[model samples]
Structures are given as structure tokens and as C-alpha cells.
Target: MQIDVLIDVKTTLGEGPLWDVQEQRLYWIDSVDGRVFRATADGSEIRAWQVPQKIGSMALRKNGGAIVALARGVHFLDLNTGDVELINDPEPNLKNNRLNDGKVDASGRFLFGSMDTLEDGPNGALYRLDADLTVHKLQDGIVVSNGPCWSPDGKTFYFSDTWSGEIWAYDYDVEMGSISNRRVFAVLQGENFRSSDGSTVDEEGGLWNAQVYEGKLVRYAPDGTIDRAIPMPVKNVTSVMFGGENLDTLFVTSMARPPLSRFPTDSVQGGSVFKITGLGVRGLPEHRFAG
Candidate 1:
């Protein structure tokens, strides 16, 4: 299916596009710009929040607020009052590390990853935040950590180490919040495919991965097979989410990062949100901040 550019925000580093069903709005972040943006379904009424530092990802909380991964900590944000409270900060000893890409799991727990600010540092880690605001370190030694999506049945986990260009599957125990039996799910080929960034799971347990440099989103079956490819007009497709009233619109976020110097001039669709209609299965609802 052909993707159409819906909004051109021209963000310096756009990522984490999430749909809020309750408010009927879309939320996303511009990491380099330190801005959080919200817009209507049709890209109208654009609103922004000026964060103190880079924001990696955000999700609606179960308790009626939002949780944002900002700088080196996780914060609780009040959507109605615009108040941001620091909730948790792991790896406080690693001054150069900060949170990266993340999402809330089906069980209403926030699963996020962090990376070393100074490139090549082996300090990145993945974390799971429970409903009670307790954070648990799941894995370590990651570089440029990315997706942490759950399968449809909530029995498997799909995660990626962007710098390594590999996606892995894990046996997820939701009740205990643990992952085991790690195995390679897919190994991306070619130098053009920079890395796998943010991702989401469809109803059939297929993983939809956003290829940051390749300018495409790929759907991979649970058995490590390529199901289909959705090409993007921009070269830096950061992340994707399924939205719309019927959950049929696929909302995509793009970036204007390095190795794509043509951004401001040659890149026409860079830093824009595109939508693909009538292609994807309904997505699970986002978890709200209960604390």
C-alpha cells in the first residue's frame, strides 16, 4: 500500500509516534529539538511541550497521565496540568547514559531502553516499569537500544539493538515480567538498512519494524519471514503506530539525521508523519499512568 505524507513538522530528530484514543490525539517527540508534540487525527491543532532535555518516548499512563522517558530518568507528566515530575532514574552512576526508545506493554507496564550518550560506550540497558512505579532492569550491554514489543498473545517479546542491526525474539512471562530463550528473529542485510528502530506488533503477531536509514517499514512474520514492505517517501523512517477510528491508519514518524545530508534541501518528506490507510490490524490500547 502507498503511504501518504500527512503532516510535515520538520523535526530535527522525530521518533515515538503514539496514538491516544481517549484524547483523540497523536503524540510524538523531536529528540534533538527537546520538544513533545500533539496533533489531531488529521494533523490539525498542533501543540508542543518544551522539555528540559531529550525525550526518547512517551505513553499514556493507566492512572490518567503520561509517562515520558526524559534524559536519564523516567518522568510522570500531567496532560491536563502540564506538570512533569521525575519518577525514576536508573544508572545514575553512568552520567553519559540516557533513555532511548520504549513503549508500554499489553499488561500496562512501561518497557524502555537506555543508551550511552557517548557513542561506543557499553552502558545501554533495558528496563521494565511496573504499575506501582518500581523499575526492574531486564538486560544490559546494549548499544542504541530500540523496540520492546509484545506479541499478540503476550507470550513473546520482540526487541532490537539498533547498532547491531539485529532483531531478537524472547519468551516473555508476563505475570513475572521476565524474558528468556533469546534467539535471533531477523538479521537485516545491506549497508543502507542502518538499523531497526521503534516497532509494533499486529494482531497476527507479525512485527512491523521501522528501518531508520533504509526509508521503509517491514512486516515480519513470527516465524522470521518477511511478510510485506511499505516504502516511505523519506529516508529516515523512525517509528510507526496504527491509529484511526477503526485502527486502520498506520501513522509513521520520520527523521533527518546524519548520512542523509540531503535533509533540508533534497529531502522533501523528511521529518514528516505519513499515514497508510486500510492495511494494518487494530493495535492494542496504550497504557495510562496510574501512579
Candidate 2:
């Protein structure tokens, strides 16, 4: 099936793309532009929300708000009023670090990662936010930590260290909130694609990952086998998510960043949200922040 461009957002550095089932809307962020956007499934009724700093990701809450990963901390955002209150700040001393890709686990806890903004910093770290707003460091020394998807049964965790070019899986104990037995799940075998970015797991436990710098979205089986490839019209495919009433519609977000000399024209689908219909399995409902 041919993928169609739904909307031309023209984002500078588009990243997190999420689906809000209750509201039947899509939410995403422009990390560099510090803007959060929401729109309908057909790319209508677009609205932009301004944030004080760069936003990495956002998860809806059960109580009619959202939990957002801000520059260096997590905040509780009032959906109706747009008021943001800081909840927790990890690595406040690290001036060159900021929150990156993230999502809420099935248990409603937020799992996010940080990356080094400074050129020579020691990579980054992955963290988990518990029910009481306590942040715990799960993994460290990650260059660009992305994807944090859970299997259909919640038995496995799929994540990517974007600079490593490999997707890793871990045995997850949902009740205990722990991950162990880490193993490589898949690796991108191309020179143009440096690593995997945001990803989502389908109902059949398949992974759909955005191939950054390669301008493609790839589907893979649970056993680390390639299933199919969906090409995008632009480089820097940042993230993907399944939405729509039946959850069979795939939404993709891309970016138009530096090194413009390589691609002279900005006329491509650089910063737009594209949609592919009838090509995805239903995704698990997003966990809401109850606390």
C-alpha cells in the first residue's frame, strides 16, 4: 500500500508521535522548536501548544491531564489550562543533558531516556518513573536512547540505543518493574541508516521502527527478522505510532535538520506526518498517569 502524507507540519526536529485514543487525536512534538502539536486523524483541526523548553514526549493521564518529559525534568501538564508543574528532575547537575524519546509502560509508569547535548559527553541514560514520581536509573552510558516498547503480553521490552544501530530486547517482569536478560533483537544493515529511533509493538508482537537518516520505516518479527520496509519521502524519520479507531493506521513523524547542503531543497516531505492504512496491527492502549 502507498503511504500518503497527511499533513505538512514543517517541524524543525520532529520527534515523539503519540495517539490519544480517548480524544481520537494525535499528539507530537518538535524537539528543537519547543512546540507540541495535536491534530485529528485526517490531519484537520491542527492546534499547537507552546512549551517553555524542548519537550521529548507526553503521555495522557487518567485524570484529564498529561505527563510530559521536559528539557531536564518531568512535568504534570493541565490539559485544559496548559499549566505545567515540575514533578521530578534527574541529573540536574548535568547541563548538557535533556530528555529524549519516552512512553508510558502498561503499568502507567513513564519510561524515558536522556542524551548528551554536548559533543563529548559520556552518552546518556534510561530511566523509569514510578507511581510516586520517583525516578530510577535503569540503564546508563547510552549515546542516544530511544524506543521503549513492550510486547503484547508485556513479557519483553524492546528498546534502541540510537547511536548503536541495534535494537535490544529484555525479559520484563511487569509486576516487579524490572528488565533482565538483555539480548540484541535486530540491527539495521545499511550505511545510510545509523540507528533506530521511536518504535511501536503491534498486537502480534511485531515491531515497527523508524529508521533515522535512512528515510524508511521497518517492520520486524519478534525473532529479529525483517518483515517489510515502508519508504518515506524524506530523511530523518523520527518516530511512528499506530492510531485510528481500529488501530490499523500507522502515523509517522519526520524531521528536517542540519547538513542542509546535502539536500538543498526543503520542498520534500521533511517535517510532515504521514499515514499508512490497513498495514498495522492494533496497538495496546496507552497507559495513563493515575498518580
Candidate 1's TM-score: 0.93
Model 1 spans > 4 angstroms off: 259-266
Candidate 2 regions off by >4 Å?
Answer: 118-121, 258-267
Per-candidate TM-scores read 0.93, 0.94
Best by lDDT: 2
Worst ten in a row by lDDT for model 1: 257-266
Residue 270 deviation, candidate 2, in Å?
Answer: 0.5
lDDT of each: 0.82, 0.83
Error of 2 at 15 (Å): 1.6
**Highest TM-score model number:** 2
Query: Tens digits of per-residue lDDT for model 1 on 133-172?
Result: 8999999999778977888888898998887878999999
